[model samples]
Target: MSDDPKQVLRYPQVQAEELADWRFFLMRLHARFRTGSFVRGLELVTRIAEAAEAADHHPDVVLTYPHVDVDLHSHDVQGVTSRDVALARRISEIAAELGVEAAPREVSTLELALDVPDAAEVQPFWRAVLAYEDHGEWPEVTDPGGRNNTLWFQEAPGATGEAQQRFHLDIVVPREVAEERVDAAVAAGGTLVTDEHAPAFWILADAHGNKVCVCTADGREASGE
Candidate 1:
């Protein structure tokens, strides 16, 4: 755990916890604001983009008429870092200036990640099996109408054997509730694989050896992308 990459701090353990007033959910600093009008939402997006540019950080912005959602995470490190926390505070300030009301509960999204030897070779089978339309670059398939969960394929560690994990679940939850979830899983008899990524993710397994990751914004997604 000590030898692993250094930027994997989870939730309140982050570098700038004091400045980050936004909610941590689904592996990103997520917040939704009621902009009151389509034009207002667009303006808010512009402000956010400018703020992001100044901070040298960017966020995934979902701008719907009268609603704007922003998700911030450090993609390179596959977790939320100090940069995300700082930027989230800036976003909140921008929202306040715009008189936007936060409705973070309204913004939540989940995705499925599958690790395989090669995404290109295995994508077709999963696509056909799930009937999800191919979209974006390699390693992603999505429901056309965005109704069902989106799927992402990742390259597995070479030759994952019986002991290595072949499949796992990444379950995202609000940052504040993360610890409780981990406790429940432990109480239910799951084994903790590692706490090195706590707040980001907790790797655990059931008695039969079926593994699942209770993941959050800081949890590293298995996908390289």
Candidate 2:
């Protein structure tokens, strides 16, 4: 655990057995529960909401038919903290009471993108820092463990002489639901950054200026769409 309670934990720092079947990706703790029925899922959410209210820590939830996806994080601190850990434990107990099972941790994939003035120079340092394999084919560093997010460096046009966000999140979701996710985010006060590469990836920014990219599997390769 980090010395500071509010400190964001790195991938390796988060222990596997500590999360009670939850997965840690970037700054959030994620768990997808199979409730077996839509009504059961709703019940689970209600219980979770009550628990969150009692604890004063809420999680972002998404319900899709028989599955409920719960994501816990401390947005103010910009990362997962002890608060998330505690809430995850409570969530697991609630899931158990509802007889819901969690999906495997590896079901979710996370990738980190860096906007830098030069990819060549920045890539080497990150590769060394993570002791990762050089996937020269895509020019990105790959984590051998596959537990941490893959690091990709992109060139930021005119970045050398100006200030720009260097780090951001890239969330990979199913292609069929990309549009729905993008629309939901826009409806939640997030501005759409660009859709020029529709069905491939859409960039969106929160009111606080933090940027995130919603990406799909191969919409970018098929028919150059």
Candidate 3:
């Protein structure tokens, strides 16, 4: 293990070719593997559990009939770190041993965002209604079981009028995948609202002007914006 397992690694620091199977999105590492059958997926999951137990670091795993999804992050540091990178490598190796191929491009996470004049005032209501738990220092709520999409409150102050869309989605995907999605959306009649936050996020609007953001972890730590 590294001397500083808790040291958070920036997106650039962890983007080596060995991690091609994984994607950095929203401060975590995500990967998906096609297992072809539920039995094979369960076998991979069992190996992952053994590896995680040995390393004393665990990842979130989900098994389905044809795929196994894994999400890795150092929860204590609230970000990806050397620990996650090492564990991700181990899991990838385990998947390879099981003849499971990775589908990196298919790994993505969705989050809901609510624009409000007073995030502090509105956050409690949503948290309670959704039965979600508070996470990090942000006014965000997440499913306690990690099944549903996370909900984050964006304080837009005076921007919450009837003219503005109060809710939108933040789709976190790989940097290259995000660009591809943006292109596809534009081809399908969606408009690019702004790339002012490119790589970190791109604001896009539908034909009716409803908005969503395609996001990645690139340059987020450097810009700190």
Best by lDDT: 3
lDDT of 1 by residue, 175-211 (tens): 7777776666666555677878787777765443446
Off by over 4 Å in 1: 1-6, 14-21, 112-124, 127-148, 152-225
TM-scores for every predicted model = 0.50, 0.51, 0.70
Tens digits of per-residue lDDT, candidate 2, 58-148, equal 8888787979888888866757887788888999999998788988463475677766666665555445434467764576887665446
Which one wins on TM-score? 3
Better of 1 and 3 by TM-score: 3
**Candidates sorted on TM-score, descending:** 3, 2, 1
Q: Model 3 Cα displacement at 193 (Å)?
A: 34
The residue pairs that clash in candidate 1, if any, are: 27-217, 200-219
The CA-based lDDT of model 1 is what? Answer: 0.69
Instruction: Report clashes for each candidate as comma-separated counts.
Output: 2, 0, 0
lDDT of each: 0.69, 0.73, 0.81
Q: State the weakest 10-residue window (summed lDDT) of model 1.
A: 1-10
- Model 2 segments beyond 4 Å from truth? 1-5, 109-153, 156-225
